[model samples]
Target chain A: MEILIIILLPIICTIMIAAVGRKSVFLRNLFVLIPTVGDFLLVGHLAWQVKSGGTAASLNLVDLSNFAIKFEASGISVYMALSMTFLWIMTAIYSFGYMEHEHAQVRYYAALVLNLAAAMGIVFASNLVTFFIFFELLTIAVYPLVVHEETDAAYLAGKVYGVYLLTGGAMVLMATVVLYCLTGTFDFVPGGIPALAQQSTFMLTVLFVLFTIGFGFKAALVPLCYWLPEAMIAPTPISAVLHAVAVVNVGVFGFVRVIYNIFGPTLYNKMGFGSVIAVMAAITILYSAFQGLRQKEIKRMLAMSTINQLSFMLLGLVSFSMIGMTGGLLHIYYHSFMKITLFYCAGAIITQSKNKYVANMGGLAKHMPITMTCFAVAAVGIVGLPPVAGWVSKWYMMQGFLEMGKPIYAIIFLLSSLIELGFFGPPIFRAFFRKEENNSFNFQQDTSKFGSEAPWAMLAPIVIVAFFSVLFGFWGFVPHGLVKPALSGLLGKGF
Target chain B: MITNSWLLFFAVFIPLVSAPLSLIFSDKVSNRFTALSNVVNFLVIAGMYSAVSHGKLLVLELNTGFNFKLSFMADSLSLLCGLIFIAVWTLTSFYSIGYMSHEHAQRRYNLFSLLSLAGTLGVVFTRNLFSLYIFFEILSVASYVMVVHEESFEARKAGLKYILMGIIGGLTLLLAMVCTYHITGTVDLL
Candidate 1:
C-alpha cells in the first residue's frame, strides 16, 4: 500500500494543481513543483528500503469481483523505479525554466507528471498483465508529448507512432489472452511457463514468435523499428524520457521479464530459440549502426544508434549467460544516461544555435564548451570506450558471447563496437578539431548572443546524467551485492 | 444494489456531465468552474487509486439490459492506466490553458478533455468487453473534438481521418470482443 502511494501521489497532485492554479501563473508553477519533489522522495525511500534488503510491500485490489489488482517491488523493480523517479525529478526541474517562455506551460508540466507516473507504474508492476497495461498507457501518454509542436511533421510522426505501437499492442493483448488461457494466471514466475513447456514444441515456437514480435516493436528490432527514429519529432525532454529512459526501457524490460520470468532460461534454451533471437539481435545491431553512420541529422543518428544499442542488450540476453544478462541490465541504466546526454547536447545545439545537422556543427566545441564536452564524454560512453559505463556492458556482452561459444556473435559484437566508433566518434572529433569553413559558417556572430547555453533548467539534467554515466560505470566495477543477487534471482543459479 | 455500481458508471458519466456543464458555462468564469469540476473529479479518482492501492477493490456492477453485467474494477492494470489518464488530463488542461487561452469555446474544450479522460479511464478499468467497447467508443467521440479543437478545415480533416481509422480499428476490436464472448460465454476478463 505504501509503495503504491509513492506512485499515485504525484498523479493526484498534478490534477489538483492544474485545476486550482487556473488563474494564477505563479500558483500553477508552484503547484507543479510540490509533486515533483514528493514523488522523488517516495522513490528514494523505496530505493533505501531495497538497498537494506527489506522485503517489498505488495498491494492487491479486486475489481468486478473477478479481476485482481496487484503491485510489488523486488530489488530490480526498486532500482528501476528509483532511476526513473530520479531522472523525472531532474527533467521536471529542467522543464520549469525551459517552458517559461513557451505557451501551454501548464500542459507541459501536467504531461511530464503523467509520463512519470506511468513510467513508475511500469517499473513496479508485478505481473505481465499489469506491465502490458502500463506499457500501452506509456504509448498513449507519449503521443501528445511527441506532437507538442503540432506541426505537419510532428503530426505525421505521431501517426506513425500510433500505427506501429497500436498494432504491436494488439499482438501483446492477443498473446496475453492466449497465455492466460493456457496457464490460468498472468503473474510473472521466474523460469517460465511450466505448462507451456509441457505443450508441443511447435505450439511453443509459435507462441514464442508472437511474444517476441509483440515486445520487439518497443525494443526496436529491424522492420518494426521505423517508428523510433520518427518519434524523435518530440521535444528534447520527451526524447530523453521516451527514447532513453521510459518507453524503450519498458520494451526491453518486458522482453527480459518474458524470457527470464515467463519462459525461464532453461526452457528457452531447450526450445532452441535463443540462437534465433541472437541472430536477429546481431543483425539489428550491425544494420542500425550502418544506418546511423549515414544520417546527417544528429537526433536521427542518435535514434538509429538507440535501435542499435537496444539490440546490444537483446543480444546480451539472448546469449542466456549470466554475464550476458548482467550486461543487458547494466546497459539499461548506462545506455539511458549516455544517450540522454547526447540527446540533451543535440537539443541544446539546436535550441541555442539553431544547428540540427552535424555538417553545420563545426567549431561548436569552442562556442558551447560545456555542451560539447558532455557530448564528447557521452559519445565515448556510447562507443564502449574504457572508464565509461558503456564499456562495462559491452565487455560483459563480449564475455557472454564467448562463454556461450558463439564466436560469430563475439566477432559481430566487436564489429558493431567499431561501427559505433565510426558513427559517434567523428562527429565529436569534427566538432572540436575541424577548422571552421571560410564560408558563411564562419564569422557568424555567436548565436548565443541572444541566449547563453540552453537554459540552466535543460543544461543541469544533461550534465547530471553525464556525471551518472561515469558514476554508474565505477559502481559497476565495485562489487554491488544488490544487483548481482537480483540478477541471480532472475536468471537462476548456475548462471 | 445498482447504486454501488453507479460509482464506476459515474467515472464515465462525470466527463459527459462536464461536457454539458462546460456548454452551460461557456464563459470565462464557467471555464474556470469547469476546470475546478475536473480537478474535483480527478481528486476523487485519485482517492480511488489510494483505496485500490490499499488493497481495496472498488467494483461497480451494472446489468447492460442484456444478459451480462457491465462491470468496472480498479485492478493493478486499471489503476496504472487510471493514474496516467488523470495525470495527462491535468497536464493537458494546464496546456490547454496556454494553448487555447485566446480561443473561443474554451468551455467546450475543457468539457471534451474531461470526457476523453473519463472515457479512457473507463476503457482501462472495466473488465467487461461490452463496457470496454462502450467506453472505447466514447473515447473515440470525445477525442475527435480535441483533434478538431481548432475548428479549422485542416483540423477537421485530420479529425475525420482519425475518426475513420478509429472506426475501422473499433470494428475490428468489436469483432474480436464478440468472438471472444461467444467462445468463452462471458465478456468478463479472467
Candidate 2:
C-alpha cells in the first residue's frame, strides 16, 4: 500500500500541474511543491524502516498470477532511492528559479517530474522485465527534456540519443525474452541461473555477449559511449540530472543488478567471464580518461569523465571479491555527488559567463569563488583525493582488484586513476592560475555583467551537493547493512 | 467478480479519465483540469503502492477480444517503475509550466502527455505478453505526439522516423509474442 502511494503521487501531481499551469502560476507552483515534499518524506520513511532492520514491502498485483508489480527497498535499492530523491529535491529547487526566465515552463516541469518518477522506478524494480519496462520508459521520458529547446541541434542530438538507447533496449528485450524462455521465472534471485551453467557453453557465451552489449550501452563502455557526449546539448539542468545523476546511474546500477542478482558471484567466478569484464572495464577507464584530456568543451570533458568513472564500478563488479563489490556500490553514491557538483559548476559558468570551453575560464576563481571552489573540490574528488567521497570507493576498488590475486588489474586501476588525475587536474589548475585572456572577460561581462554568479536557486543546490560529496567522504561510511545482506542472499557466501 | 476488479479499472481509468475531461473543457480550463486529473491519478497510484507495500496484491482483469483475460499485477518490480514514473512526471509537470507556456497547441501536448502516462502505467501493470504489446503500442503512439509537439518540419520528420521505427519494433515484438504464445499456449509473463 505504501508502494502504491509513492508511485501514484507524482502522476497525480503531473495532471494537477498541467491543468493548473495555464491559469494560475501560484496554483501551478503549489501543485508541484506538494508532491516533491511528499515524495521526499515517503522515501525517507522507507529508508528509516530499512535502517531499522525492517523488511522492505512488496506489493503483488493479484489480477495477473504471473505478473507482479513490486516495490522492495533492500540496502542497495534504498540507498539508490534515497540518493535520487535527495538530488531531485535539489534539482527541483534549482529549476523553480532557473525556469523562471525560460519559455514553455510547464512542459519543462512536467518532463522533469516524469523523468524523476521513472528513475525511482528503476531503483525499486525486483525483476528483469519490470526493470526493462522502466529502463525503456526512462529513455522516452528523457527525450523531450533533451530536445526541449526544439533547435535543429537538439533534434539531431535527440535522434542520436533515441537510436543509441533504443537499439540497446532492443538487445536487452531480446536477451530478457530468451532468458525467460529458458528459465521458468524472471525474478532476480541471487546466485544466478544454475540451470544456465548446465546449458551448452556456446549458449551461455552468446547470452553473455547479448547482456554485455545491452548493459554496456547505458554503462557507456567505450564502443557505445558516443551518445553520452552527444547528449550534452540538453539544457544545463537536464545535463546535470541525466548525465550526472539519473540516466547514467541507472545503467551502472543495472550492471550491478545483473552481476550481483542475476549472475551470482559463484556462477560468475566459475564461468571465467570476470577476467574478460575486468579487461574491458580497464580499457574503457584508460581510453575515456585520455579522451577527456583532449576535449576542449567542459561538458564534453565531464561526459568523458563519466564514461571513465562508470568503468570503475564495472571493474569492481568483475573483481569477484567483497571489497570490489562494496567499492563499486560506494562509487555509485560517491561518483553521483562528485559528478553532479562538477556539472552544476559547468552549468553555472555557462549560464553566468556564456563560456563552454575550458580555455576561456582563466581567473574564474577570483570572480565566482563559490562556484569555482565547488568545482575544484569536485574535481579533486573525481581525481580520488583524500577527504573527498571519491577516494573511499576508489580505495575499495583497488583493494578488491588486488585481493583477487590480479596484481596487474591493480596496476591498471592505479594507472587509470593517474590518467584521471592527468586529465581533470589541468582544467582546475588553469582556471585558477592562468591570467585572464583579453577575450575571456569580454564574454563573461557580456552575459553576466549584472552579476558574476548564478541565482541563489542554482547556486544553492551545487553548494549543498558539493558539501555532501566531501561530508560523505569524511564519514567513510557505506550503508551496506541493507544491500550487503540482500546481496549475500543473492550471491551466497562466495561474494 | 467484475466489481472486485476495481484495482484494474482504477489502473486504466485514472489517467484515461483525464483525456475526455481535458478535451471537454476550454483550452485554458482543460489544461488546468488535466493537471488536476494527473494529480488525482498519481494519488491513486500512491494508494495502490501503499496497498502493495502492505503485502497486498493490486491486480485487475479485463476481457479481451479473444476469450482471454488481460491481467495487470502490481509487484515490487512494477511498483518501483511506477514510483519513478510518477515522480518524474511530477517534476516534468513543474518544468512544463515554463516549457509549454508559449506553445500554440498546449492542450494537445498536455492531453497526449497524460495519455502517455496512462499507457506507461498500463505497460507497468499488465501481466501478459499480449497486454504488454497493446500498452507498448499505445505508449509509442502517444509519445510520438510529444516528439513532434513543435510541429515544425524537422519535428514532423523526426516524429515520422520515430513512428516508423517504433512500428518496426512493435511488429517484431508482436512476432515474438505470437511465437511465445504458440509455444506456451498462454501469453502469461511469469
Candidate 3:
C-alpha cells in the first residue's frame, strides 16, 4: 500500500496542480509544494524503515511471466529517492520566488511534479523494464522544462537534450531486451544475476557497451557533455532542479544500478569495467573542469561543473571496492546539497542583479550577502575542504581509489579539487573583493527578514540547503547514516 | 550518553566550546577562564583514568547510523593520551597567563590553544579511524593560526608550508583509513 501511494501520488498531484491551477494561482502554488514535500517524507520514511531492518515495499503491475513492471524500495532505491525528493522540495519552494515572473505557470508546475514521479519511479524500479520505463518518462517529462521559454535558443537546447537522451534511451532499451532474453528475467538483483556469468563473453560485452553508452550520455561523460551546457539555455530553476539535481543524477544512478544491481561488481571487476569507467570518468572530470573554466556565463560554468562533478560519483561507483562505492554513493547525497545550493545562489544572483558573467559579478556580495556567502560555503565544499560535506565523500573516493591500487584515479580526484578551486574561486573573489563600478543595487542587510535580498522564498532554501551541507559535514549521523546501510545491503556485506 | 561516560564529552568538548570565549574576555579573565576549563577538563579525564587503569573500559557510543556507532573508548592507551593532553593543557593555561602578557594578539593565541587542546583530546579518546580523522583534521587546521601567530614574513611562509604538509598528511591518513575500511568493511579499530 505504501509502495503504491509512493509511486502514484506524484502523478495524482501533478494532475491536481494542472486542474487547480486553472482556477486559482494561489492553489496552484500550494499544490506545487505538496507533492515534493509529501514525496520527501514518504521516501525518507521508507529509507528509515529499510535501514532499521524492515523490508522495503515491492509492487508489481501487469505481470506477464517475467516481463512485469515492478517497483521495489531497495536500499539504493531509497538512497536515490531520499536525496531526489528532498532536493525536489527545495526546487519547488525555490521556484515560488525564481519563477514568479516567468510565463506558463500551469505547464511548469505540472511538468515539475511529473518529473518527481519519474525520478521516484526510476529509483524504486525493481526491474530493468520498470527502470527503463521511468528513465524514458523522465526524458519526456523534462522536455517542457528544458524548452520552457519557447525561445529559439531554448528550442535549440531542447532539441539537443532530446536527441542526445532519446538516442541513449534507444541503446538502453536495446540492452534491456537483450539482457532479458539472455537471463530470462527483467528483475534487478543486488550483485549481478548469477546466470549472466554463464552467457557468452562476447554477448555480455556487447550488452555492457550498450548500457554504458546509454547511461553515459545522461551522466554527461566527456563526448556526451555538450548537451548539458546547451541545456543551460533553460531557466535557472530548471538548471538547478532537473539539470543539476535530478536529471543528471538519474544518469549516474543508472550507472550505479548497472554496476551493482545489474552487472555485479565481481563481473564488473573481471571484465575490467572499473578501469574502463575510471578512464572515461577521469577524462570527463578533467576535460569538463577545463571547459568550466572557459565559460564566461555563470550557469554555463555550473553546467560544465555539473558534468565534471557527476563523473566524480560515476568514478566512485566503479571503484570496484566497497569503500569506493561508499564514497561514490555518499557523493550522490552530498553533491546534491553542494551543487543545488550553488544553483540557487547563481539563480538568485542572476535574478536580482542581472549579472550573468563572472567578471561582472564584482562586489555582488555586498548586494546579496546571504546568497554570496552561501555560494562561498558551497564553493569550499566543492573544493573538498573539511567540515563541509564534499570533503567526506572525496576523502572516501580517494581511499577507494587507493584500495583498488588505482592511485591514478586518486590523483585525478586531487587535480579536480584544485581545478574546482580555480573555477569556483574567481566568482567568489570577484563577488567579495572586486568592486562593481557605479554600483546602484540595493544592499540587503538583516538576512533574517522576509523578502529581504531576493525574496525570503529563494533566500530560505539557499540558506537551508547550505546549512545542511555544513550539517552533514559535522553531524555524522545524518548523511552517513543512510548511505552505509544502502551500500552494505547492495554489496551483501554486513558492516 | 552511553553508560556513565558522559564526562568523556566534557573532557574533549569543554576545551572546544570554550575557545571563542577568550575573544570576549580581557587577558586576565581569559586566562582564568582557560585555567578553570582546563582544570575541569583534566579532572574529567583524570577521574576516568582510575577506572581505565583498572581495565574498566569506560565506553561511550554515539549513534551515527548503520550499525556503526561513533564509539569513544578510554582503555589504558586512550586514558594515557587523554591524561597527558589535559595535563599539558592545564600547565599551559598557567604558563600562558604570563607568556601571553607581552605578546600581541594574546586573545587569538588563547582561543586557538584551547581549540587545539580539545581536538587533541578527541583524537585521544576515539575508538575508530573515522573519529580520529575528524579530530586530527580539526587539530591540524587549528594549529595553523599558531604557526602564523607571530605575524612575521617568515611566519607566514612557514605557516603556508606547514598547512600544505598538514593537508597532505590528512589526505594520506584518509587514504590509509579507506584502505583499512575497504578490507575490514568497517572503520572501527579492534
Candidate 4:
C-alpha cells in the first residue's frame, strides 16, 4: 500500500491541480509544492528503509492466478527515485518563477506533475511490462508540455516526438511478446534470465535487435535521433527535465536493464553484444559532440551535448564488469545534477537577457556573474575536469573498459572529453574574456544590480544543483558507495 | 497453481467484452468506460506478476486432440507485454481526451483505438503462432482508423498506404504460417 501511494501521489496531485489550479494562483502554487514535497519525503523514507538493510519495499496491487502488478524499490530503484523526486521538487520550485508569465499555467503544472509520476513509475517498476507502461506514459504525458506553446513549430516537434516514441513503443511491444514466447517469463532476475540461454541463436539475435531499436529511439542513438534536438521547442523547465532528468534517463535505464538484468554480463560477453553496443555508444559520443559544436541555438547545443554525455553512460554500462556498470549507474545520478544545472543556467539566461543564441551574448559574464559562474563550473565538470562529478564517472568508465581489455573504448572516452571541452569551453571563455562583437553591457555602471541576475526562484536551483555537481565530485564516496551495492545486487556478484 | 480460467479468458478478451457497451453508450460515457476498463486490465496483468514469476503458469487449451491442441499460456513475459500494451492504450485514451477536444468522429476514433488495443493485447497473450498471427492481423486492421483520424485528404492517403502495407505484411506472415503448419503437422509452437 505504501508503495502504491508513492506512485499514486503525483497522479492525485495532477488531478487536483488540473481541477482547481486555473481559478486560484495560490491554490495552483500550493498544489505543485505539497505533492512534490510529499514525494520527496516518501522516497526519502524508502531510501532509509534500504539503508537499514531491509528487504526492498514492494507492493503487489493486483493478484491473478498467474501474475501480479508488482512495484519494488531495490537499492538502484530507490537511488534513482530519490534523485528524480529531488530534481522534481527543485524543478517545480524553479518553475514557479520561470513560468510566471507563461500562459496556460494549469496545463503546464498538471503535465509537469504527471511526467514526474510517470518517471517515478519507470524507476520503480519491477519488470519490463511495468517499465514499458510507464515509459510510454511518459512519452504521451510529456506531449502536452512539449507542445504547450501551441506554435506551428511546437506542433511539428510534438508530431516528431510522438512518431518516434510510439513507433518505438510498438516495436517494444512486439519484442516483449516474442521474448515471452521464447523465455516464458519477463521477471527481471539478477544477471540474466536463465531460460533465455536455451533459445536458438537466430531467435536470440532477433530479440536483441528488437530491444535495441525499441529503447534506442528514446536514448537518441545515432541515425534514429534528430527528434531530441527538435524537441527543444518545449518550455525551458520542460526542456531541462526532459533532457537531463526524466526521458533520457529512462531510455538509458531501459538499455542498461536489457544488458545487465535481462541478458546478464556473462551471456552478454559470450555473445559479443557488449562490443556492438559499445561501438554504437562510442560513435554517438563522438558524433553528438561534433554536432554540439555546430548548433547556433544555446538549448540545441545543450541537447546535442546531452546525447553525447548519455552515450558515455551507455558505454560504461556495456563494459560488462562490476566497476563499469557502477560507473554507468553512478553517471545517471551525477549527470542528472550536473546537466540539469547547465540546462537551468541556459534557461535562466534566456529568461533574463532574451538571448537564445550563444553568438548573441558578447559579455554576459559582465552582468550575470552568478549564472555565468555556474555555467562555467558545470561545463568544466562535463569536460571531466578534476573535482567535478563528471570526472569521477568517466574515470571509473575508462578503468572499467581497460580492465575488460577494451582499450579502444577508453580511447573513445578520452577523445569525447576533448570534444566536450571544445564545445562547452568557448561559451565560458567568451563570457569572461572574449566579449561579443555587438555588446550591450555598460561596463562603467554597477553590474551587480538585482535585476542583472535571474530572480531568486530561478537562480537558487541553478546554484544549488551546481554546488551538488562539485560537491559530489569532492565527496565521490557517497554515490560510489550507493551504486556499488545496487549494481552488485543486479549482477549477483560483489565487486 | 490456482487457475481461474474464466477470468483469464476475459482478461485477454476484455476489449471485445466491452465492445457492446462502447457501441451502445454516448461517446463521453464510452470513453470513460473504455479508459476505466484499460486501468482494470492493467491491474489484472500486474496482479499476475507474482504468480507467473513463481512458475505458476496459466494455460487455456481449446479443441484438444491427440495430434494437435490450441493453447494460450500466461507466463511472465506475456503478462509483462500485456502490461505495456494496456498502459500505452490507457495513456493514449487520457491524452486523446485533450487532443481530440476539437476533432470530429471522436466516437469512431475511440472505438477503433479500443479495438486496436484488443488486438494488441491478444497478440501478446496468445500462446500459439497461429493465434499470434491472427491477433497481429486484427491489430493491423483495427489501427487503420487511428492513422486516418483527421479525415483530411492526407490522412486518408496515409491510411490507405498503412492498410496496403499491413495487408502485404499479413499475407507474407500467412504464407509462412501455412508452410510451418504443413511441415510440422501442427500450428501451435507450444
DockQ of each: 0.01, 0.01, 0.24, 0.01
Model 1 segments more than 4 A misplaced: A20-22, A63-66, A438-451, A477-481, A492-495, B1-190
Q: In candidate 1 chain A, what residue range of length 10 has the lowest lDDT sum? A: A435-444
For model 2, what is the alpha-carbon lDDT of residue A110?
Answer: 76
Candidate numbers sorted by lDDT from highest down: 3, 4, 2, 1
Candidate 2 lDDT over residue span A11-85, tens digit each? 787788788887888887776666667777888788788767787777654325556566566656767777777
Residue A455 C-alpha lDDT in model 3 = 85
Better of 2 and 3 by TM-score: 3
Best by lDDT: 3
**Top model number, DockQ:** 3
Report the C-alpha lDDT of model 3 over A1-495, residue by residue, as the tens digit.
Answer: 666787788899899998889799899888777788888888878888987988777888778986788888888888888878888888888999988888898899999999989998898888899889999999999999889989999899999999999999999999999998899887777777778988988998998899999988899988877899999887788888888988899899888888777878898889888789889999999999888889999999988888988999988888876667788888888888899999999999888877788878876766787799899878878877665787777877777787788888887887777677678877886675456757634444442422336988899999999999977775657667777667866765411
What's the TM-score of each model vs. the native? 0.69, 0.70, 0.81, 0.71
Cα displacement (Å) at residue B163, model 2: 54
lDDT of 4 by residue, A1-495 (tens): 556777898899899999999899999888898878888889888888777787888877665644556688888787888888889889998999899999998999999998888988888887778887888899999999889999999999999999998888888888878877888776777888888887887888888888888889888888777889999999989989876678998888888778777887787777888888888988898899889989989899999988988888988898876566777888888888888999999988887877888777666876787799799878867876534566547656765776677867766766667677667755765675445566544343355645578789999999999988877764655566567557866786522
Q: lDDT (0-100) at residue A122 of candidate 4? A: 85
The weakest ten consecutive residues by lDDT in model 3 chain A span A443-452
State the lDDT at A470 in candidate 1.
Answer: 64
DockQ of predicted model 1? 0.01
